[model samples]
Target: MDITNFVVSARNQALLYGDYNTYHKQLAKKLHNCRKRLNIVTRNRGKFSKKEPISAEKLSENHEYLHLQLLTAERAWAHAMRFKAVHSADTKGITGRTRSHIISRLDKGARAAETLVNVLSDASTSGASDTDILEARAYASMLRGATQFEKQSWEPCLRSYATARIIYTALSTSMRGDIFKDLLSETIDPSIRYAAYQSKVPRTLAIPTIARKAFPSSDSALVEQINKLAPDLLKKSDSDAQKGQVGAPNAPQTITWRSREVKIEDAAIALALASTDTATALLEEKLASSDVTLPREMAAAYDEVLIASQDAADATKHAIDELKEEGVSQNDPRIQSLQITRTAVNYQMISWRIGRNRVLSGEHDGALLDSAPTTTRKSKKDATSRKPKIEPTGRKISRLKDKVVLYDSTLQSIDSIKELPGVAADEGLLEQLEATAKYFRALKSLSIARSHSLTDQSPNAYVLTKHAFDECQQSAALFSKHGASSSDSSPRNIEIRQADIQFLHNLLKGELQRTRAIVQIDSQRQKAAETVPPHGGSPLVQRLFEYPEGGANLNHLVDFPPKMDVIPVKPLFFDVAWNYIDYPGKEPVAATTPEPEQKTKQQAQSQKKGWFGFGR
Candidate 1:
């Protein structure tokens, strides 16, 4: 049966909505239902029936009996957890009585689990599978570990927890779920670490190594079962633990950052750093052999190195946190050294992360646009050979957008490196990081420009392309001045190669010219379009405001041989000139007008009446 699943699901369902007390109540109700189903429950008002211990025969008869035993054990465990949580805030600490009470509850759970294990182990009578037996054993060991943990018996607690861890770790390999992993990470690992610490195990040893050492080797059956599940796990753990001890071959004893080497005091960091070195070598070998590797494949190859570096960084952070928790002052020599180590590991991690982005961004860090073949024939190949298919403009634009995103990520990673503890104080390193950021920014601009060009936005493309070119130049100069020394060549991070910079410089130079030409051609085309008359038949005189495109359409010039039409002149001028000069055929008649005396008198009277409508 899936014991872990059953227990975890019960805990989650109860604890998510309530707490352990609630879980205990729920388990009690479940136990009652199970007993009722088995027809062994006491009747109301009847004499109490003595509970009999669960046995293999009952489990064989009905699997519900196993369920009943599991619920009983889980109820007890929850009750203990609830009691412990309730008394956690006591100022004085847990009293001896309360501690004993808690341990009693845990012991009861352990006994019930042990009973289940015994029943399952009797395979001939219980009809239990090997896997079911092992699961029961692991669960029982977990409960026993909890009991010992509460009792402060560190060695026994470590041994019991290690057994559970080893079983769960083995089972997790064959199982396709995270239940075992969750138990290991969330429950068993922490308990084991604490118990090991209390048992005087050195903090330098990793939890897995500790668990392996404390695993009950005397239990032949357990060892055989775990071996069958994971054949090399025990041997591998031994080898891993040996890799970083003093005088071990290829052990990472120290790490160098900016020519300053610091000793690797923490075994976890040392192990992680050694793994990183191995991963870096492997990555280099893979990349070197696969000349035509895909971008994503190359990126995937970096994951191992990235993970190792991140582990080192995390280990460093954890060490620092542990020291701080112990009330070690910031000015302590150990604290100061750890801070430096933290910066170094974090920088290395970010460097590899940026390297992965660089790989994804494509050749020359995406400075050059990869043009698709548009021709079917080449001088070097057969004419009948199929040509590479050209991607659609939309697809090309999408690829450029992807490159832009990678460049943006690279820029962000470079920025993050600046925030590391001592990076900003290191002038040369800071310059290199800034230069790297500028380089990625240039690449991002180039990507954006290429996308714009694909979308027929010539002006925007030209502007962005020019900006990219300028940024690339500035970054190249800075890189040349502040680049890492030649002795530091490694595949762990991006190296600003002179050849790559030159190639990108040439490509961006040509791209700037190409984009400029495109812009000018587009502008000329627009100007020509604007100069074209709306009506083709309009004469030059009528279209004087418009520039003559296509040489003014000379065939429709000036209405050809000019057509006759009425023209307006000043008629009043002619009338005035006629009066000034004599005409040959016109008689000189009286120029004076004949006026009526009555009209003159009325005009004079009106002029007099204008003043007041009456004369005074």
Candidate 2:
């Protein structure tokens, strides 16, 4: 898998962790778009739009007016559905009303396409050229985009729109005046169009748009429904699975993802989970050690899980074939695997995911082990104006021990699947994997050093902290040595690198040097004490015999680490699942899955007409 996309996707998911309706609805929208794109592209029989290009167009000036109305209605209906999806994503919930209206609009839009097709079928004179057929196809494609948009199917919606743009651009070259104006009259928003066609996320993706805007937040309780529905990646999620698109007739793979992929992703996930667990544990330790209810670093602990879970979810989620732009049937099995690994991607953390949010919301002391007991509350409108007979209950709380247990259990489960067949890493991926391990080890080390500083008065705290600082330096060097920084210049990368540098300079030159200034027991008390300020100068080292509490800001020590674990990944995931057919690989259990077809670059170029894009 492209680590960057995988990380980005995972982060987006974890951010919406407590709010699943938005996430699932968004996923469903993408799936819906895939199905619509499949329907339009396969049925139309042409590269530009429908399956076939228009060979002719013969319509009187009178009939032209009716055609315009139908075409206009089709585009309008499609957009209406897309907007409905956006609303659902924003609200973090979907309504029956939204689905019903979308279905109604979709049907009308389909009818419009049929009508256009019928009208074009009758005329053999003026509108029969490739451009006319393409125009009709573009309408069909746009209509597909509309339905996909309604579902908020991310890529397919954009792909459909992009495909339409390419067709319209081609048509525009040959035709002009009212005919062209009519065709170009209703297009998707420019930003969306650009992002979709270029396969790039628009900078303003998170910003509200005129065509698709975010909805108001919904009740938190609804999240429970999603948790009940899907407990983990091990089970098929209800989001897109209910649509029957996965492993169904509309399953979208043109290539076979092999066993080797399953191995690499599983390892990456295992490490991410480990990191999350470690971070959460450290924060729990911090919470337990002090009278302070919250630590400044507590948020960072939550962040570690947020980052890790997103990576885990992305790695573990089932794959769809329609997302692939090209099939890699014939290629090196060792080198070319799906962007997602072919391993049966399964992991569970729904309860944990929900549990984390509860823990954060003060619903728990630390981790949640069970559901809340029933409770009663007083109503403002009560005649007595008193509390209800049943005792009222605030959100329940769990302990740090329980939270650690759950985190450990979660990691253990993933560890079970870490060694599926050919999941071994290549040289480059191995380096990335090692770097990930070393990175977490460094995190745990820092937590240890922090805890030591909190309690230890001996020079041990300084010694331990200095070691942790050294580990950070080594991890940064390891990342750079593995070429992560050069390959990815994202802000996250810069942050990690800079943090490491800052800590290294402070520890080696400042902290270590400060330790020498402190009064050592072996030295003359007068001389050593004179070298430094009096005791209790600063809390950071007061107990440690005079370290500065005014030392490095802890934020730099524990900001979210930039993950650069991408190995020139070819893609993920589950093709067989989408087709709803589970057949074991013909190869032996110990053997790897191999490729079947290899279309050379020459063959690809020659077959360009089969794809939807401008000639250039």
Candidate 3:
């Protein structure tokens, strides 16, 4: 019958477009139509009539009767919600009379739903399927729980909500829709948690465990029905909860940061921490089993650990937020401890993130520009006789570009660690972080230099390589003096070793020398190109620029064999200057006087003209 689907769909459609008042009006119209269809409505101003209740025996006659019963219950529920929606924003809160009125309406709805369940569960008269009966039962329990919730009856509310939770959980697994899952997250879970809190249940117990314990097992038939739907729903939760417990033998109960240890009071944080440890071990196993694991594959392995660590961090943040929301002072012991826990979890999360980036970079943190291993071919002839394939210049530079991105990410993660709480106060830790940043920066510079070299930017590559060498020297010096504080053989971020530092130092040193030599050769070539003319001039001038490849030609003086050549000169300079300067045929015009006839004509014209140029 999809009873739950029908209810949830109606609620969503009405609430999405309008509030409960609209829903109430719509339900009323439907009920009126239903009554009119049954020929039970008063006609032509006749006396008013009350609709009769739907009987269990009559429900089998037609499915409309079942719909009528559901609509009736929903109408009552919507009416109460209408009141709730109206006064929800009132500062004074619900009055005593209004609370009782809302509870009364809710009670009627719950009773109607309970009556519907009883009618649906009858084997002889009820025509509904087992699933329909189960849905009706869960719906009734939820309404009853809501009624008890408003009445401040925590124990009964907890039990009622637990019943709904269990049924919905079973239906969620078997059903194909998200209605049950949405109900659990958006409604059932929060109510159960709040009621459990009021009932003095420990906050550490998960919703599933609480639901399992509070479920009304006294009803044998309901238990049987639930068991049939989910055979191990009740049994499996026990073992799962035990396995999820922080007190379990395998689960970690405490987290240590710096010199202080804090007990993990939150179960979610402990579970996440435990999963992170498991993922770390699994990553190690995968890395050990494969001799040439691809960077993507290693990165994929690290994702699990990173996600677990992020969850732990988020859980810690949630705990701190909750404490603060309750007006807990920062100086409170709980809040202070949570702040420390937050820092520790955040540090761990960023460490794993940086570790992922480090793995994505090639061996030795990309100090050596090695091609990524893309194939796993084995040779039977000599077992170790595989030949190295020379990659193209473009492909090598492309790989280096990828490594540079990874190194940049690693550096960013290190900087984020410094921003975490309590990290700045520890000078030793700060030095370690700075050294780690320098190490990644050196690798980044090296990758950039290699790319520049591949593109024939010799000077730029030389400068970058030199900078990289200096960073490597600084990082190596720091590592040599203090070394990494952590001695764990397993890989972790900010865990630089002496051998790796020395290896990078040697690498950058060699790269600096090689790039400097290339730069010098390039500079000499440029100087020779500039000095030697493009056109073949005298062999003596060309020989002065560079040594003759075929030995000095003593017989050749002007060209290779004394051939004729044109020399460029300024032939037009004298011609251009002659135009500007006075010459015999072209004397300066200003140096000559005007003609006598023209001068006499100008005087005559001036005498003939009147004042202001009027003609006389």
For candidate 2, the TM-score is 0.25
For each candidate in the order shown, give its overall lDDT on alpha carbons: 0.81, 0.42, 0.81
> How many steric clashes between backbone atoms does each model show?
0, 52, 0
RMSD per model, one decimal: 12.1, 37.8, 10.5
Shift in Å, residue 382, candidate 1 = 11
Give the range of the ten consecutive residues with the poorest summed lDDT in model 3.
Answer: 242-251
* Residue lDDT tens for model 2, 1-616: 1111222343256345634334435444553454464343234554564434222342433334334434344344535545564675655455677676775676567566645645654445533443444455556666767666656675667655655544443444444434434434434444244344345453212111211221111423222322332233113333223222111212112222332223332222343344445545554565455432432233334555455556545633322231232342435442234343333222223323333433332222221123433234435687377554532222222223333344344334334434443335445544544554444344344334334443434366466556655665676677777654322221121112444444444544454455444426424665656554444343332244535444533333322444455568644655435445434873232244434343364346646744474331
The TM-score obtained by model 3 is: 0.79
lDDT of 1 by residue, 1-616 (tens): 7777888888889999898889999999999999999999999999997888888898899989999989989999999999999999997777788989999999999999999998899899999877788789999999999999999999999999999988887888788558888888889988987787678787667777898889989989888988999887676654555563322335477778889888776667877777888888888888877452667777889998888888889989988887786678999987888888898888888878887887777776766677532223355555457676767898788778888788777777877877888887899887877776777788788889888888899999999989988988998999888764423235536556666666778888999999999999999889877765444466878778977546676656687568786898767676557567766986464577637885596567756863566531
**Could you tell me the C-alpha RMSD of candidate 1 in Å?**
12.1
Per residue, candidate 3 scores C-alpha lDDT tens digits across 133-209 of: 88999999999999999999999999999999999988876787489989998999889987987798976667788
Ranking by TM-score: 3, 1, 2
TM-score of each: 0.72, 0.25, 0.79
lDDT at 16, model 3: 99
Which ten-residue region of model 1 has the weakest summed lDDT?
Answer: 372-381
